[model samples]
Target chain A: MAANSRFAVAAHVLSLLHIHEGGRITSEYIAGSVNTNPVVVRRIMGMLNKAGLVQTSPGVAGATLARPIDEITLLDVYRAVQPEDGSLFAIHDNPNPDCRVGRNIQVTLDTAFTRAQQAMERELAGMTMEEVCLDIVNRP
Target chain B: MAANSRFAVAAHVLSLLHIHEGGRITSEYIAGSVNTNPVVVRRIMGMLNKAGLVQTSPGVAGATLARPIDEITLLDVYRAVQPEDGSLFAIHDNPNPDCRVGRNIQVTLDTAFTRAQQAMERELAGMTMEEVCLDIVNRP
Candidate 1:
């Protein structure tokens, strides 16, 4: 429930771009599709623009992927929108360090999360945004 | 920085059990080791015990795994502690369902998350908790 908004936002934005690949689509239109405020879309666009995943224009303009959708994996979009985290999971801090187990709880968690995320990324790396979009298009 | 605490607690508790195997341990001690309240340990213990991952008792009691440490994969621990997920990645709610992508993002995201999580579990299944513990015990 608490994963984060960036991944979702990135997906939404990419889907919007896929729908309007040739024509420049305004953030307002994208936000309308996402049901979120245009300002939020714009903010995320600014970050993606900085990350070079997207090319943006000023005033009533929209953004599009700097590269082809076929070349972008979910991991590419994820990394562009979300910072690289070693593990997909995070450890709860303030563990009882006084106890031996507490002292190593974070350590153990780090290992598990890191391994799990690496596994997830390896799988995700196999698919491109085109594949995702194609799947959506072909869906019944 | 955003990860769940469930696995953290489970792994810590399990590691402690392995460290002090053959000896009964109490939730209070486990909680102390996890740096959480005894109540928290007790709650987790209830589930772990049900999953046959651990055993527990009343007063002057602690918990231990039902089987040897080598038999428990991280996947076993994860399944034991996974909480109810309201949404996979917290995609925008109230999205314009009339929009094609909006109508489909949820479905697509859920599928992707499922696949990603499966890949993660497969990876976790490859290693035992013993490997994790040894890494720690042997850590310099």
Candidate 2:
């Protein structure tokens, strides 16, 4: 799950929180909604909370989006789950730099990945959980 | 892996093809550029070719971007590799559809995913393979 899917999970949780629209919800309930383990839900919440997207409380408490659902973008959720590892699309480790193409491929891939991620972020930037909530309401 | 990195691999390959600038390179070479196995490279290439993002040759052959890399965006590469399976984010399969929150989460997720992917494409629309290649040449 280290591959950046928490965005999906985070969005799901946030949508639920938005639906609740008032108070915190337990990880157990959220996990039930997700059909995943409570630990999984809590872990995702932890990540989201660390990124300032959500706030968590212990004991008789659960989690809530730090801001309005519409204020949160997919990118915000993504940043919360990203491991300290590196870029979203870093090149392979220790490429065969001996080869002419391999030697320089990193540079090219970096630029491409950068552009791709920028594109992704830009795309994500245009949206908020509010739009998603609207669609959910409109769904047949 | 059926995870996020797969897209990174596809983007890496397409970015390399764009850098090749229409030069015919074998899958082995593409894999080499990606630092992954050639078989895996060929497999992904086969998918890309099928998606019309690339053209491949049979028997000891390589692949080339079907569209100019500039005309292509990160979304194009992602589509070629993954075929837009389901949603961009994974939600629980057995959500409590009975509950208002669980019932509508999928629709919300879909809308969010669509907007996010579109924003990513629009941002990517600002770049071209030529810029990616030039960045490679200029990188320290």
Highest TM-score, which number? 1
TM-score of 2: 0.72
lDDT of 2 by residue, B1-140 (tens): 32345565676677667666657777777777667798888888888888888887787454766876667765566566665553445555667776666788766776666766665556556665556555555654
Off by over 4 Å in 2: A1-5, A21-24, A62-65, A68-70, A84-90, A130-140, B1-36, B51-78, B83-87, B123-140
Tell me the deviation in Å of residue A22 in model 1.
Answer: 2.7
Query: What tens-digit string does per-residue lDDT give for candidate 1 at B13-104?
Result: 78888888878777777776777787887888777888889877666475667988899998888788876652335666767788888778
Displacement of the residue A27 alpha carbon in candidate 1, Å: 1.6
What is the RMSD of candidate 2?
A: 4.2
Per-residue lDDT for A17-64 in model 2, tens only?
A: 787867667888888877779898888888887889877777756566
Native contacts matched by each model: 0.68, 0.48
Instruction: Please state the i-RMS of candidate 1.
Output: 2.8
Q: Against the true structure, what is each candidate's TM-score?
A: 0.86, 0.72
